[model samples]
Target: MAYQVTLQPSGHQFSVQPGQTVLEAALHAGYALPYGCRNGACGACKGKVLSGRVDYGATQEGALSAAEREQGYALFCSARPLTDLVLEVHEVTAVQEIPVKTLPCRVERLERLCHDVMGIWLKLPSSERLQFLPGQYIDFLLKDGRRRSLSLANAPEEDALLELHMRYVPGGFFSEHVFNVMKVKDILRIRGPLGSFYLRESDKPAVFVAGGTGFAPIKAILTHAFNQGLKRELVLYWGARAVRDLYMPQLPERWAREHANFRFVPVIQSPLPEESWSGRTGHVHEAVLADYSDLSGVQAYVCGAPAMVAAARRDFVARGLPADEFYSDSFEFQGGPGT
Candidate 1:
């Protein structure tokens, strides 16, 4: 059985399947409802149930006080619709809506994703949560008064373990430390949710071109898009030197297999004989250029070396992609993100 769930003011409606919580249905229907600790510990998802009834699935007593529940408020994260319902909630509109935070995080896990890419997972203090747009980044503050910017690779919804992709740069201080000395439980200070490279709400199709670890930000963006069950079509072209260079290839491949609206194109620059490579070869942007002659109708997000970004932007616009629709963030091996 299913019931219709409608948002107040906007009157946007979506169906709540029998097993789905209100929050789950809302997100699946492309609605961004504010939430924290979907486990019902936080009241961030609390909203007024203007009409109809809910089961008020499991939740902590203090999270949804008895008096608050009596007043027609329910924690949407733990609420299940008993009938058609109306809720009052606001969508996150801009960066101002989310606080830029400076918090200490523990190195929860360190995973070597490839020869050059290492995945870092940071765990925030139990009492603190960093609210950030999916593609935003954080600057790790070093004791030497320097900062290294690392993009959050995980989506906002799965933020319990904030994810970062670090490429092993031989002479880079931060990358060298992360690959060598960083250990689990190492306390790190950081300030962020910075950068403007977030997904803009658009119904237009999206084309993403990622180079090396530049896929970090795009991974966050696309994961959020998928979690929201967005209807827009998305095509991603990730470029690398060889098959081994394309770390985490299974992820986008799985996304392509699972989502009808998603497509993944792995572009290998050059493959050696033993590689047995038969996939798309050459520059990542060139693959996009080959597939899309008229990108004016779609949005293009490119992340790579400065030269690649510049070339992709110039050629994309020349191929009819709107100047405004082309967004890019270039990687700085010596500096950091957005530098």
Candidate 2:
């Protein structure tokens, strides 16, 4: 049996089929809901059920605490509708209309940006170019049925070759294969561009915080903004462990030099003496907080480790950043229930 689900405020409705999660139904109906690690780990798709019943499927307890459940919040990615339901959740309209596709691509180049970060450029078929927002990601379909997710580092306007930045996790199978075995002309299948994190249309100034390889999507967003001739002020704070971790530092520096509306700040967490690093120190989000005492008038986009993303969201919203104005995608190595 299928049940109808209605979104509060917008009143957008879709049908949830038997065994299908609310998220699956929403996606099938072309309604974009905020989600990450669709596996119920990230808590990005949490929403309140205003009516009817749902089978709250498997979810990490930390992600959806019993207290949160008592408060009427459900993880849409893992919640299966038992009856007609009304839910309260913000919809992402930017990518709702964009078609997601599974396509074959060939590895065109692999440029190692640092000891642990590799820049992957995939060449798609000549007849088709992907249509995606700046901050969306693509999942590489692997032979063993395992999928590797990587954010598109290049903006949509620069779609000749899809760019991705991948961090080398020492014992990770796919990552190790990419660094050691993957080659030019290697054929790969990918489904993209997924995720709700993107550069939204806003008149407010933008603040971007990126940690480690999380700079990929932010780079795309900023580049697209510049290409579109946006006059809004944009400041990026990139956090890294050391100078070596600051891959492509010159690119953001160049951007700052060329664009009067853009500014780049590099924050090194643990700078080594021999690296000759001198910059803002500590967490990327904290750096932003230090600069802007009141973030009431800005749109903040952050991508990084789970801790950083969570801390930033909590602190930023607490410091006057409208809870709705903050956009984020927390990097989960083992992404949960990815769409």
Give TM-scores for every candidate, taking all chains together and pairing residue i with residue i. Answer: 0.71, 0.92
Error of 2 at 315 (Å): 1.4
What's the distance in Å from true for residue 257, model 2?
1.2
Q: What is the lDDT of residue 220 in candidate 1?
A: 96
| Candidate 2, 1-339: lDDT as tens digits | 989999988999998888899999999899999986677665678889999888899887756778889988999999999889999988988797888999999999999999888899999999989999999999999988988888999999999999999888766788778899999999999999899999778889999999998899999999999899999999999999888999999999999999999999999998887877657888788899899999999998888876677678778887999877888787764334221
Candidate whose TM-score is highest = 2
lDDT of 2: 0.87
- How many residue pairs clash in model 1? 0
Q: Report the poorest 10 consecutive residues by lDDT, candidate 1.
A: 330-339
Shift in Å, residue 89, candidate 1: 31
- Residue-by-residue lDDT tens digits, candidate 1, 1-339: 999998987889999998999988987676667553455654546689999999999876645668889999898979999999988776544764666678998999999999888999999999988889887788899888887877889999898999998878776778779988999999999998765567777899999998888899899999999999987999999999898889899999999999999999999999877898989999999999999768789988877665677678678878998755766665565444223
Where does model 1 exceed 4 Å of error?
Answer: 1-93, 334-339
